[model samples]
Target: MISLTNLSYYLGSRALYENASMHIKPGQKIGLIGLNGTGKSTLLRLIMGEYQLDGGTISKAGDVTIGFLNQDLLSYQTDDSILSVAMQAFERQNHLQKRIDGLLHEMEVNYRDELVDKLARAQDEFAALDGYTIQSKAEEILEGLGFSTDDLHQPLRSFSGGWRMRVMLAKLLLQKPSLLMLDEPTNHLDLPSIVWVEKYILNYEGAVIVVSHDREFLDNVVDSIVEVSGAKLNYYSGNYSFYLEEKALRNEIQQGAYENQQAKIRQTERFIERFKAKATKAKQAQSRVKMLEKMDRVDAVIDENARVNFRFNFSTQPGRHILHLDDVTKNYGEKKILTHANARLERGDHVALIGANGRGKSTLLRIIAGTEPTTKGERRLGHNVSFSFYAQHQLESLNVEDNMLEELKSANPTKSEAELRTVLGCFLFSGDDVFKKIKVLSGGEKSRVALAKVLLSQANFLLLDEPTNHLDMQSVNILIQALDQYEGTFVVVSHDRYFVSQIANKIWYIEDEQIKEYPGTYDEYEWWMEERKANPVDTKTAAPQASSNSNGKLADKSEHNNSNGSVNGKKPVSANDEERKEWQRALKKATQQSEEFEQKIAGLEKQIKQLEAEMASPVVVADGKKMQAKTADYQRLKTQLDSVQEQWEDAMLEAEKLEKKLG
Candidate 1:
């Protein structure tokens, strides 16, 4: 547990947090959120002790380990495998195992009784630590984060930067510290991997503090939301969705109060100016002036100037059919992505293209945008259709040598200097930001520049792929709203469900080299999927094409489990009865081992006590040799007792694991 009291932090002259106070309770999961440059990462650093508080105090409970997983990956041995790096989380267990091995070797060489006792004690400590589960836990976490079984044995240095960060994440999760701090954890994860982490955090036993721009992930995982805004930390009792509603209500109330106070102040000042010099009304005017002076000014509910306002401008309108694709097939060597895929889009259609990662979503978008050619496909764009594309790679496509203003001008060469400056200002780039070189800009800043270019292009059609990758939540919402109101037709490849749900009027679901069209919002599509699961169709027959109005029928139903299994329907043949039986057997064995260790420990304790009583007798103390011999026996019994006790503790820990798994 940690508490921040009257915390204050400053970045040069700008105040990040002033008198910001909050408490992170044990096992509480908190989502830290705010606009970009609002010090979400800085607060995590403060909790990690990377930054010294300028004023105030941060108190943490004693011996509470904190696992902080930042974006950077610390260097490791070049030959160390990924699994080995993750297993380093069990440093204590590793050391104890080594000591046990040394004692085992000593016993093998000399066969000393003391050596056996030492080895037993060491083995007990290692088992009590659940040392045997380390490798499995590491592998499980790595796989959950999208690493394959083959990746476990690969050297850590062989992974790319993003994958290396995932390795660090696995290490942090395996550490199982008292407190876990992750900043932008989903930045590199695919949709499925993100879902895995969401479920993992929800089931985690320790405290979690994660900062993420993915609204849906935060909404699903965290119990509380913390907003770092207006140089203060604000607490919300519920998830991100709750925070949004509460924040809006709070702002509305604050605005009303501020307006009322301003009105009263204006009335008092006017009375004072008009009647202060008069004799009859002077007292009332003076009293009003005093009241005005004592009144506490209510701060207006205006966000800081650092906010992005997005609106797309288009050059021309497209025909009724914005885009059409028939017999679309794309292949990379032997691996086929799309096989005779067919889709149609009308004017003003907002479509979301979603599927698992590496499923040709981005490739399809490129093919549609004319950036890439399909292997065997007939694609056509409607007359007067002009589109702009934004991808992850486009963020780096900006000319590093050019400043922000120059880049904007190049994108929209017809726009004058004044017009360009105004556009940049709306995107939250002003004054010196316009002069900032592309090479020196941060990731978020670079994203804003790239987006600004897309907006400035004024294309009637948009082909965007992961447009919200580097943008903060506020920026994402702004884009969502802008796209919602835009007249142009757009096809977006996005993993942000929240953003897609808000902007998309139709869904493009891809699976098994097929692109199926579902007409409805993302939320509606989710509902339809649940209905299909609840009333499953036979795989033996041909699958029915999902109707456009299917979403409307299931839209109002409650959320359902998407996991593969049978509940209210016929039993699924995929159930693993053998695996379940094996797990039960393991649990039973662990419990029996724990009971046996307890009995052995109890017997050792009794023997040690008897030996102590015998050595303490007055008859043995009077005889020097007898006393010395009794003392030696007492020491031997004590050593054996310690070993049994350790064994008992280890068995108990293993039993606990089994109990949880069984439950």
Candidate 2:
């Protein structure tokens, strides 16, 4: 267990958090949340011993290894490949292995008995730590984080800074310290990679502390959220969504208390004033004045969220079909994203677009929004359908030299300086933060700035792509409430399931170059997916139903045979057509088998992903032995999967050979 007593951090003259205290036992995943500059990152730095506390003492039992994913990527430095960068986490293993190697080189007979025993012990320790599998483990972590096979051999210096941050995260997870403190770990990850990381965090055995804007990941991973507000750390025992509901109730109670106290004070003052002029009531009046003076006051801050209700109004009533994209096709050179895709979006539809990473959910939205054009077919927007797009890469648009307040001023000319600061405060930016240049801001801070800009845009049709990317739980809740009350249309692409459930009323699922709509919230969509699994469509039966043939033509078997050619067991086709029929059957079988393998692979991949996400939590890396074991298991499973994949691939090759033989 780790405990801090009256911890405080001083920033110039102001204390970001004063006398704040918290605790962590074994195996509890926690999320540290606050507005931008509310000391979340500072708190993590304090815990990691990177910064000294201004006041109060921190207590920890013996060596508690901490793996921190700092917002800044300067900590993990190497000129090696991405794989080598991640593998650096196994430094201790590498050190021990080196000693073992040196020992092996020395002749055993030439060495003293004591030297021989020491060498043997060193080798045993290295093996027990699973030092032998470091290379494979590093490769697996890199691949799981969306690194391509080519990227493995590619030097880390060849990658951009954002990709370098991913490599940094991969190292932290590979190290698997007792306490894992992640600051916006998912910022650079795509949907599939995010999902993979989330799954990894879930199965992690040690304690975890995550600082993220992705609500769905928190709801799935963290058991609690610690919110920093009013220069204090407030602990909430719930996930991101839970914290929102709880905070809403808590805020309501606070508001009532303030109102009631003010009302009583006003009544007391009135009575004292009325009796002041009367001689007989003078004593009572004086007594009342004394009583009033002695009364304790209820101090309450104004609710910032109450201010920025930039009511988005549709400029024009769109057609019944607000958007129509028929047989839309797109490709980047030979890499096809969407092929023969079709979809329709109507006015007032709260739609969510979802698919695996790099599958073009955002690209399709861009195509719909006209930021990008489809290669073929047409995407038509209804008359006067105005849109406010929130790109996932919003931070890229920010001017690095501009301060927070300046950015806001530039984004919305009509917004007053005071009003912009208040709005920024509501999103967790306050005081000097408004003066901080964009270049020095954290990923989460940049995300908030973008979101704050979007809120002020006042567009009726909102298109958001991963809007909850770098937020802590508290900010996400505030956002959820804001979106829920929104009366206009929303078309968002997010992997944050909780946020999607709160705001989306319909879903656009992209699969096999098709956009499928699930006309409900995330919960309803999930339920529908479950139903489909429980009652899957029988391909053999559904095939005939889906086939289109003129009824007049079907009546003639001769014509049908000329087109399709029947099999011998059912009906005779062309002479010597058995091989061709068998080929078709094999293809069908392979398709089914491939789908099944993909599903299994998906499930395994999901679990692995959860493990990565859990690694980002504050709990998993907070305990020594537990973190070590969790990481050991992660490496072991990765190896098992690789071996299994090799076998699976071989089986598939055999199946393909048989298919060719039959043909």
Candidate 3:
């Protein structure tokens, strides 16, 4: 167990934690939450001994091992293969294997009994640690974090910085320390990977403390919440949802007690003031004054400025049908994403697009916003349906040279500086912060700025991709409130279930190259799912009734297939014949694309191999310019190869689906 007993920590002259006490018993998953700059990361550092305590003690069991996921990506070995780095988690097992090998060599050379005994002991230790399964286990964790099988063999330096962090996280999980403390672990992860982390943490046996802005992640994984604010700690014995409910009740109770205490103090003060000069009442007045002084004062609860106040303003109302997708298909080269997917959105419909990572949730949003083109079929936006698209990397799109005020001003040139500053203040930026350059802001601050820009867009439709990616709980609630009251349509892709539940009146579940629509809130959809799962008999027979139509609208398969086939009262081309022709054309196209992608991928791979060989050659190493040129070519080819490979995989899936239909 790890315990913090009346601990105090400081950031310069500011007290981040003062007389804060908490305990982490075995298997307890605690979520550390606070506003930005409230020392959530600092407290974790203090626990890890990266910072010295200003006062008090943090005691832990002697055998305790801590695994902290620091934000720094520079700590991992970039020169090593991803798999090799992950396998380093089993350092003790590696040592045991080495000892066993040494003992075997000794036994062969000298034929000694001592060598045999040493070998036996080493082998036992190796088996005890499950050394043989270490590599597989490491790979499993890495795969869960969104790494491909091919990625495992690639050098860490080949990947981008965000992916490299995932490699570090994979290593940390493999280590399985006594305490697992993650600071914003989901920052770089996609929705699927975040879901995987949630499951992994829930099943984790060690004590866990996560510092995150993801409310759904906390709700799913953590059983306790430790809120750090105003140099104090407030503990809740439940998840984020429960914490909110309980905290509100507790605060209300505190307010009531404080009000009652203030009333008594006021009455006593009035009595003392009225009788202090009267000789008959002097003694009683004196007694009352002493009583007042001795009484334990009930301090008024201080409610922080925890939420941003704003509304999403729109210039015009959209037509009833906000957007429509008819037989829409999206693919990169041969890699198919959405295949014949259809959907329609009506005005005032707040839909959530949810699916696994790389399954085209964001891609679909991009398609609808006209930022990306559809590979096949059509997409139509309703009249007056102007949208503001907020991509996950919207912060990166900001001009680094521009200040926060300038960025907001760019969004709304007509708005005055005072008006822009007011909006920025709503997003927690004011005074000097508004003057700060966009480049120097932290992830949370940048996210707020991006949100502020979106708020100023005043578009009637919002296409937001992972808007809550770097926001705090408070900011999330603020956005939720804004969207809840907004009179516009939106299709937001977020892994935040709470935020989605709050805003989404309809859900578009994209899975298996198709979209499924559910008419109702996320909660209702979940309950319906649970009810279906509970009755296996009903579930088995319900599949045919729930298939989607040409427009991706939910319908009875029998009725939809028969009625929707005949358009404009014309006798439709035989459904099977049309389907067969389409599939045949798709198959031929996919096969040709797949072959072309294969050739490109092969060429790129060959080039990469040749470059690696040349880089390893002594002659090339001796020439810096030659080596640099080869390395650059190698990186460029590798990136192209990755894209081609993705396309090839998509083509293969499309081909398979076509073949199955043809058969």
Question: Top model by TM-score, which number?
Answer: 3
Quick one: best lDDT, which candidate?
Answer: 3
Error of 3 at 193 (Å): 4.6
lDDT of 1 by residue, 1-663 (tens): 799999999999989989999999999999999878889989999988999998889999997899998865544436789999888888998899889888877777789888888888888888889988888888999999988898899998887666888888998999889999998877777777888998999999999999998999999999999988889899998998898889889999999999999998888898899999999999999999889888899999986434334455664435455776766889998888988676677777889988766688888898888777646877887655788899878887899999999999988898888888877776667788899899999888898888779878889888888888778876786677667767788989888888888999888866667677777888988887778778887522212342221221332111222245432112322336786677668878877876886677667667767876787799988999998998888778667755655565556546644554344
Cα deviation of 492 in candidate 3 (Å)?
0.9
**Cα lDDT tens digits for candidate 3, 1-663:** 998999998767888989999899999999999998888999999899989998999999999999999777545556889999888889999899888888787778789887788888888889999998998999899999998898899999888766888888888899999999998888778767988998999999999999998888899999999999778888999998999899889989989999999999999999999999999999999999999999998778877545545555764445456777767788888768887777777778898887566678878888887778645777787654688988867778999999999998899887889888878877777688889998898888888888888878988888998898768877787788778887888889877777888999887776567766777788987786667778655432333224244233445445434455753222443457778898899999999998997788777767777787888899989999998988888778767765777677678758956775576
Model 3 steric clash total:
0
Would you estimate the TM-scores of all the predictions?
Answer: 0.73, 0.66, 0.75
lDDT of 1: 0.80
Per-residue error for 552 in candidate 2, Å, reads 30
The segments of candidate 2 whose C-alpha lies over 4 angstroms from its true place after superposition are: 74-79, 101-119, 135-154, 157-164, 190-199, 238-298, 301-308, 314-318, 332-334, 369-378, 385-388, 392-462, 471-490, 532-663
Q: Sort by lDDT, best first: what order?
A: 3, 1, 2
Model 3 reaches what TM-score against the true structure? Answer: 0.75
Residue-wise lDDT of candidate 2 within 122-190, one digit each (tens)?
988888989888888888888888888888978878776667888888888888878888887776677
